[model samples]
Every structure is written in structure tokens, then in C-alpha cells.
Target: MKLPSEFIEKMERLLEDEASRFFSTYHEEKANGLRFNPLKIDRETFLTLVPFALSPVPFCPTGFYYDAHEQPGKHPYHAAGLYYIQEPSAMFVAEVLKPNPGEFVLDLCAAPGGKTTQLAAMMKNQGLIIANEIHPKRVKALSENIERFGITNALVTNETPEKLAKYFPGFFDKILVDAPCSGEGMFRKDEEAVQFWSQAHVEQCAIKQRHILDCAYEMLKEGGILVYSTCTFSPEENEQTIEAFLQTYDDLELLSIEKVHGIQPGRREWTNTNFEEMERTARLWPHSLKGEGHFVAKIKKTGPSPSWNGRYAKPNASKQMVREYRQFEQEVLQTEIEKPMYAFQHHLFALPDHCPNFDGLKVVRAGLHLGEAKKQRFEPNHALALSLKPQDVRYSLDLSSDSVECLKYLRGETIQTGEDRGWLLVTVDGYPLGWGKEVKGMVKNFYPKGLRIN
Candidate 1:
């Protein structure tokens, strides 16, 4: 747990009296947390259902503190999209934005989809949210998490901030820029962060964050709410970056973040010019809270944004594809898919409401992936199964969370179902896990092979 000597020296100089308290936190075990998905389950129901000993994260209602000894990731409920394992402090970033249902939103720099999922849940999966991650490799995980959370209204993209800004100018009602930074906050949990820490790296991250914020600003409409957050505790990437952003845009106003439950305000003295209004931003110190370090700043755009002249995405599914899918839907699903259907070659998707044309962007996933059109029949995607409830489907096979059948289903093993149901929704404790096709007395496992446990 050795920290960089330069970082230690900088912190000691910066904290003065509080350096001892801050340094002592490194000896403590890192906290583990998971947020129950309110989109799938309620808070009270989740509390009673979970086996692990838990405590609520004061700042986030859905967030719970789990013991380091517990392995919730291995549970079937996790596969059922009941909850999302996330850092407690990281959960607060989405809470600050709080995008309402039907409002267009953007999560700039979203990867691994923690904040993006939370934002989508807050929006009740009604609004269109574009979760953009710059890196090609990281965008895969972001798309997977969005699907696992039963989020139907997200458009996952792998594109640079500059590219996205050109397509979505003044399109979003709310935006979140959880900028990449020097991993000062994650040093305790990740050894790589400790090795990567440097003052020069912090400065580089600050520059990158400012550019990302600029792109986010262009996408936000007038009276839009934009929240910027970082995992690092460095003032250069925190107070200083926000100060520079506010200074650059006279139309942006820093809004006060409620500093409750061990959260503190950004230090005014940390900036180059000692920006006093930097106090409006919030900081989650490891020593002061039950979570890792984080800095958050919420702002409002007062100036009018240019009208977006982008074209709305059109339904591209052919008549034959629609006919095949509709035939399957009538036979398999109890509920009708009322949204516009889109086609990507043989694959089919239900486009989110008011979805803009993603003609040039590298789209990882667009809206709810319905399924793939195979020959004369249509096969449902695993995403379609995860997004459904027991009542949504015509037939289902429910297995207990602790049952051997549940584990077998997750492992991509065929199970024996006495009934000869064609397309059956597989569930763990009444929660949809994935799809299974039953023929004769044997159920063919449709749980995605990539996600199947060994």
C-alpha cells in the first residue's frame, strides 16, 4: 500500500492539518458496494431478498454497502439484473444529474456503464440516452451493462466527444461527463492506479476533461443540467478543471451540491486564481466517507443553445422481416412491442423514442435489440429476454435462486421441461434471466455463451 512519494508530499502540503487523517485511511480495507436496480425490483423487496448483510449508502438510496467477504457477482440474481455492483461514491454522480423520464440525455465518456445505468433507471427507461465511450475496447462493457440492467432506451456508441458533438448539438436536456482522470481515488482498491499516479498525469487529465466538458456543453440545450465528476481527488482535475470550464463559458452557472453524509465542498484555494464559487462542487473524501474519493460539480446552461437539425431515425425493417417477427411475437410474447422496428442486416432492433440518425457514429447498440431474423423464423436476442417480465411472455420456466437448475441455466446447459413450449423465458425467482427454446421435453439453452459461467 505504498503511495508515491511525490503524491504524499503534495497531499501533506495541501492538507496541512488533515494529512495524518487522510493517510491513515490507506491501511483500512476498501469498501464494496452494489446498487439495487429499481427498474427491475423495489428497494424494500431487494433488502428482504438479498442474502448478504448490508447497510444503506446514505447519499444513494438504492446503493448498499456489502462486506468484502461476500461474492454477490456469483449469484443468479446478478444475472437477473436485480442489482449492479458499483462504487458507493461513484453512485452519487448519477444522483446529481437526476434526468427525468422522456428527457433526452447524454453520458459523455461513459464506460463500464455505472453512471449511465443509474441515469437510465432515473429516467425510467422512457427517454433516449446516448452513452458514448471514446475507447473501442471499453464501449463493449458499457453496452453489456446497459442490456443487463434491462435498459431499453439507451443508444450505446463508441465515438469521440468531438464527433458526437457535431451530430448532437443542442439535443440533450441533461448530460453527465464522468471524465477520465488520474486514479488517485482508486489507489486503495487498484494497484495500477498507485503505479500510474503522477503530477504530470493529473495535468494531462485536466486538459482532457476540459475538452470533454466543452463537447458536452455543445450537446446540452438551454436550461439543461450538466454534471461533471471524477474519481481522482487531485485539485488539478477537480476544482481547477471546473473553474476553467466556468471561466470559459459565461453562460454556465455552477449550482450548489448538497453536502450531506460526510460530503464536503471543493476547496477554493486549490485553483490557480482561488475561484471562490468552486465551493459549489462536492468532494467525497475516503477518510470522511464510507467510500473512495470523488469530486462532483453540477451546472446549468443559462444561454440558448442552437437548434439541432439532425434527422430522426427511420424504421428500416423490411416487410418480410416484420412479418416474421410479428408472427413470432404473437406466438411467444403476451405483450406487443409498440416501438418502431429497425433492421441491421439480419438483426432487428426496436428504436428508442425520438432516436436521432446514427448514420456515421460507431453504434455498439441501438435501443432494444429485439432479435435476429433467421431464414423463415425469428430468433430472440438475450437482451430481449432480460428486458421482459414473467407476464410479458406466453410461457416461462421459473427456478429458485439456490436451485441446481438455476446454476445450470446460467452455465448454458440444457434443462428438461415437461411442457413443449417453443420460446420460453427462463427466470430465477420470477426475474427474467434469459431465453430458452423448449422442444419435445428438452429446453435448449439460449443464455449467451459469452456470459455463461464456467
Candidate 2:
């Protein structure tokens, strides 16, 4: 694990006495962590269900450290949206944001959705989370992670920060800019980051981060919280970037981040102005914590903006489609969808609370995708199955995760259940995995082919 000489040289001069400890950590195994979905399962229940040996991540309540040898990602529970495998230090970013339920939040530059899902969990599926990513390809992973987490209130979008700022315009109560950086903190986890590390790249990332933060500021409401984070330790993207941002926006105040569990404060001397208040930001050093590196800064917008006067998403479901969906819902679901229903042609979706009309945006998922109307019948989507509780569905096929049948289900194989009950939710230990429609004595697998365990 060879590090760049220049990076090491700079760090050695900066740390001086502590540089040895930091460099020594590169020879050690990288830490692994997973955070459970509080929206679906509690911590005690998750511990009882999972077979892995785990330890608590001190900073994040939902986060746990798993052994590097363990393969939680390959488990059936992972498909069931039970937990997210994330870097322990990366989990600390969302904890700093602390989005509340029913608040309009934006996760700018969200891709492969680690922090976005955590923010969704904190919001408890009640708020509208506009999870936006710039790259088209990366946005797919972000949307997939959101779906796998059983998140129903998110509006996954593929759009640029500037474009989103134009559409939203001071609409969010809270925002998270987990800006793209040179990946200094992620070097241990992703080796490519190490290969890409350079001082010039760091400067470019800082410029991009400032532009993104400007977009975030435009979208955030007065007194709203905006958390800026990076996986890099470079002062150009951390203390210096925040310092420049605060200077540019006099109304934006840097709020103090409570540093605990070996978390350190941002170095004030790292900035151009040697800003003393820059110490309010937090830093997660690999040598100081159980995880790799990260930097987080929480700020507040004290200035006001014009109130968003956008139209809410209207119920566009036709009478026939509504009737068909209701018939399916009544026959299969014990609970009812109480939100406004919208239609994308034959597909029906229950819009999130206070959802603004995203008519022309590149929305991967609008809201809780109810299902699609095929001919005269309503076929429920896999998203619907994952979002449901076992008690919420009328019939289900519960299989032990260790059993061969569970593997078959995950592999998209039909199960031989001796029940004629139709539209059944398949579960692994009472957690909804996917949809399995029962016909005669055979249960047809509806687990998505793309997600099938080969």
C-alpha cells in the first residue's frame, strides 16, 4: 500500500509528530461498517436477525462495524433492504446533517447514495428527499440504493446542481453537499483514489465544490441547515473551501460540529485567512478513529429568499387505473395508501408529502411506485413489496434465509408452495424481500431479474 510521496511529504510536515501513526495505518486492514434501516427494522431486531459479529459505530446510532471477512452484502437481507454497507467515517456525514421528518431536503451530488440513504432514514420516509446526481451512470446506483433501502419519500433525479437550483429555488429546509473530491479519505477503500491523488486534482475539486455549494445555498431556505462533506483530507476542499464560502456569503454562519469519539476539529491554520472559526468543522482521521478519513462542516443560511410558489403534484390516475389499483390493494394490502396518486401513463405512484411537480425533470423514481396497470389488472412493482411490512400484506411466503428455498427465491426461481393465495409477499424472517404471485399450488417469483443472485 504505497502512498504518493508528495501526499506523504505534505502530511509529514503538517502532522510532524503524529505523521508516523497516520502512515502506519495504511498497512492495516480497512474498516467495514453497515447501517440498518430504522424505517423498517429496529437495532435489537436487526441484531437478532443478522448472523454477523458486529460492534457499534460510536458516532452513528444506526451504524455497526462488521469484520472484513464477513460478506453481509451477499446475504438475502441485503436484497430485502435491511442494511447499507458503508464506511464508518462516511456514516458520520449524515449524522451531522440530521434531517427531520417532513422537511424538504436536498442531497446535492448524491451518487451511489450512502449518505442519502442515511438522511432518508433520519427523515423516516416522511419528507421529500431530492437525491440528485450529475452523472447519468452514477445516478443509477444512487436510485438503486434508495430503492434497496425501501425509501418511499425520495425523488431520485439525474441533474446538475445549477439545474436543480433553478427548479427548486430556496425550496429545501435542509441540504447536504457531499461534494466530490480527490478521494484522499477513500484511498484505503478504493485504490484508484490513491493513483489519482495529486495537488492539482485537489485544487480542481475545491473549485467544483465551491460551485456546488453556491448552488446549494440558492436551494436552501432561511435558517436551513446545509452540511458540506468530503472524503478527502485536503485543506483546499475542507477548511479553505468553507472559509471562502463563508466569506462569499456573509449571511451563512458556520455552526459548531460536536466532535466526539476521536473526531478532531478542522485546522484553522489550513485556510488562507487562518480563520479561527474554521475549527467548527469536524475531521475523521484514520489514525484517530476506527474508519478511514472524512471532513464535515455544518452551516446555516440566515438570509431569506422568495417563498417557493410551485404547484403540488396532482392526482393524474384515471378512474379505471385507480379502480384496478384499489382492487389489487384491497385484495393484497391490509393498509391503504393515503397520499395523492399520480400516473405516468399506466404506471401509478403515490406522491410524497408536499411533493412539487417534477414534470420535465429526469426523475428515476417519483415517489412510492404503486404498480403498473397491465390490461385490466394492476401488477404491483417490487418497490411496493419492499416498502410493505409483513403484517401489511394479506398473504406471504416466509423462508429461512439459510434454507435452499430462500436461495431459489433470490435466484428468481419459482417456489412450490401448497397455497392458492394470490399476490403474496415473499419474506426472509418476516422482512419483505419481493413479490411472489401464487397461482394454483405454484408461487411465481417476481424478484427482479437484474437483482437475482446467480
Candidate 3:
């Protein structure tokens, strides 16, 4: 738990008296947290069903503090996407954004999708959310987390901020720029972050964040809300960054963020210009709060920007593909998918409401991936299973969380169920885990191999 000299020197000058409390936190164990997916399960029900010692995070209603000793990540419920394991303070970012249902939201720099999932839940899986990650490799993890959370309205993409600005200018109603920064705040949770720490890196991050923010601003509609946040405490990446953004854009207004639950305000003195309105930003210090550090700033687009003029995604499924899918839907699903269905070669997807065409964009996933249509048959995807309720399916195989069969299913192993039901929705205590197809008495495991617990 050795602190870096440069980091210590910079912080001591910034804090003066409070530096000791902030540095003392480095010796403490990192905070552990999990936020229940409201789309999958309610908070009260989740508390009753889960097997763990948990306490609620005061800042975030959905977030719960799990003991560091607990291995909730290995639990079958995790595979089922019942809850997302996230850092406690990191969960607060989405709460500040507070995206409502039926809104077009953008999660700029979304990787490993903690905030994206939370924003999806807040949106109630209704609106369009583009979770963009610049890194090609990290976007896969973001896409996977989006699937596990049963997010039906997200379009996972791997593209630069500049690229997205071109396609979605003035389109999104709300946006989250969870800007990448020097991992000053997360050093406790990830020791690697401490090793990577340097003053030079912090300056680079500040420059990069400004560039990312400029792109995010372009996509937000006039009068739209945009939340900028970071996991680091560096003034260059926090108060200073927000001040610079405000200075650059005359139309942007720094909106007040309610400071509760031991949260503090941004120091105006930290900024080069000593921007007075910078105090509207909120800071979650580890010493002040029960969680690790974070900084958030909510802003509104006051000036007019050109509205997006793009074609909405049309139903492109062939007549034969439609007929085949409809037949399967009739036989297996009790609910109807009334949304626009699009096809990419043999793969079928139910397009989200008001989804725009992502032509030429590097889309990793587009809306709810229904599955592929091969020949005359349509295979249901694991995403299709996770999004369903027990009643939505014609038949199901329900298993206990700790049952041998549950472990088998998570491990991508098949089981004998003695049922002839086709397209079975496998559940862990009534929450949809994944899909399994029945052939005679053997239920073939369709749990995605990439996600196999093995």
C-alpha cells in the first residue's frame, strides 16, 4: 500500500490538512459492491433471494455493499445477469445521469459497462443507448455485460468519439461521458493503477477527456443533459476539466448536483480560471463517503444544435425469414415481439424504438440480438432467453442457485430433463439464466460458450 511520491506531493498541497485522511484510506481494504438489475429483479426481492451479507449504498438505491470475502462473481445468479458487480462509488455516476425511459442516451467511453447497465436499468430497457468504447478489445467486455443485464435497447459499438459525432449529431436526449483518466481513485481496488500513476499520464488524460467531451457535446440535443464523470481526484481531470469545457462552450451550463451522503463540491481554486460555477460539480472522496473516490458534473446544452436527420432502421427481414421467425415465436413465446426486426445476413435482431441506421459504424451489437435464421429454422439466442420472464416462455427448466444442474448449465453442460418441450427458458429461481433446447429427454445446453464458468 505504498503511495507514490509525486501523487502524495500533489495531493498534500491540494488538501493541506485533509491529506492525511485521504492517504489513510490507502491502507483500508477496497470497497466491494453489486447493483441488482431492476430490469431482472426488484431490490426487495433480490435482498430476500440473495445469499450474502449485504448493506445498501446510501448514494445509490440499487447498489449494495458485499463483503470482500464473498465471491458473488462465481455465483450462478451472476451468470443469469441478476446483478452487476461494480465498485460502490462508480455506481453513483449513473444515478447522477438519471436517464428516463424512452430517451436516447449515449455512454461515451463505456467499457466493461457498469454505468451503461445502470443507465439501461434507469431507462427501463426502453430507449436507445449507444455504449461506445474506443478500444476494440475492451468493447467485447462492454457488449458481454450489456447482454448479461438483459439490455434490449443498447447498441454496443467500437468507434472513436469523433466518428460517433459524425453520425449522431444532436440526437441523444441524455449522455454520459465517463471519461477515462489517471486511475488515482481506483488505486485501492486495482494495485496496477498505482503502478501506472504519474503526473505526465494525468495531463494526457485531461487532454484526451476534453477531446472526448467535445464529441459528446455534439451528439447531445439542444436542452439535453450530459453528465461528465471520472474515478480520479486529480484537479486537471476533474474541476479543471469541467472548467475548461464550460469555457470552450458558451452554450453549456454547469447544473447543480445535490451534495448528499458525505459528498463534497468541486473547489473553484483548483481551476486555472477559478471558475465559480465549478462548485456545482460533486466529488465523492473515500474519506468522506463509505465508497471509493469519484467526481461528477452535470451539464445542460443551452444553445441550439442541428437536430439529427437520419433514417430510422426499417424492418429488413425477408418474407421467408419473417414467416419462419413468426412460426417459432407462435410456438415458443407467449409474448409478441412487435418491434422492427432487422437482419444481417442470417442473423435477426429486434431493433429498439426509434433506432437509427448505424450504417458504416463499427457496431459490435445492434439492439436485442434475436438469433440467427438458418434454412427454415430460427435458433433463439442466449440474449433472447435472458430477456424473457418464466410466463413469457411456453416451458422452462427452473433450478436452485446452488443445485448441481444449475452449475452444469453455467458450465455449459447438458442435462436430462425428461421433457419434450422445445426452446426451454432455463431459470435460476424464476430469473431467466439462459436457453436450452430439448431433443427427446436430453436438454442441450445453449448457454454461451464464451461465458462458460469453466
Best by lDDT: 1
For 136-231, candidate 1 gives per-residue lDDT tens digits of 989999999999999999999999999999999999999999999998999989999999888999989989999999999999999999999999
Poorly placed runs, candidate 3 (over 4 Å): none
lDDT of 3 by residue, 180-280 (tens): 99978889888899899999999999999999999998999999999999999999999988988988999998999999989999999999988899899
Collision count for each candidate, in order: 0, 0, 0
Where model 2 places Cα greater than 4 Å from the true spot, the runs are: none
Q: Model 1: how far is 439 from its true place, Å?
A: 0.8
Give the number of colliding residue pairs in candidate 2: 0
lDDT of 3 at 113: 97
Off by over 4 Å in 1: none
| Local distance difference test scores for all models | 0.94, 0.92, 0.92
Give the winner by TM-score: 1 or 2: 1
Residue pairs in clash, model 2 = none
| The 10-residue segment with the lowest total lDDT in model 3 | 417-426
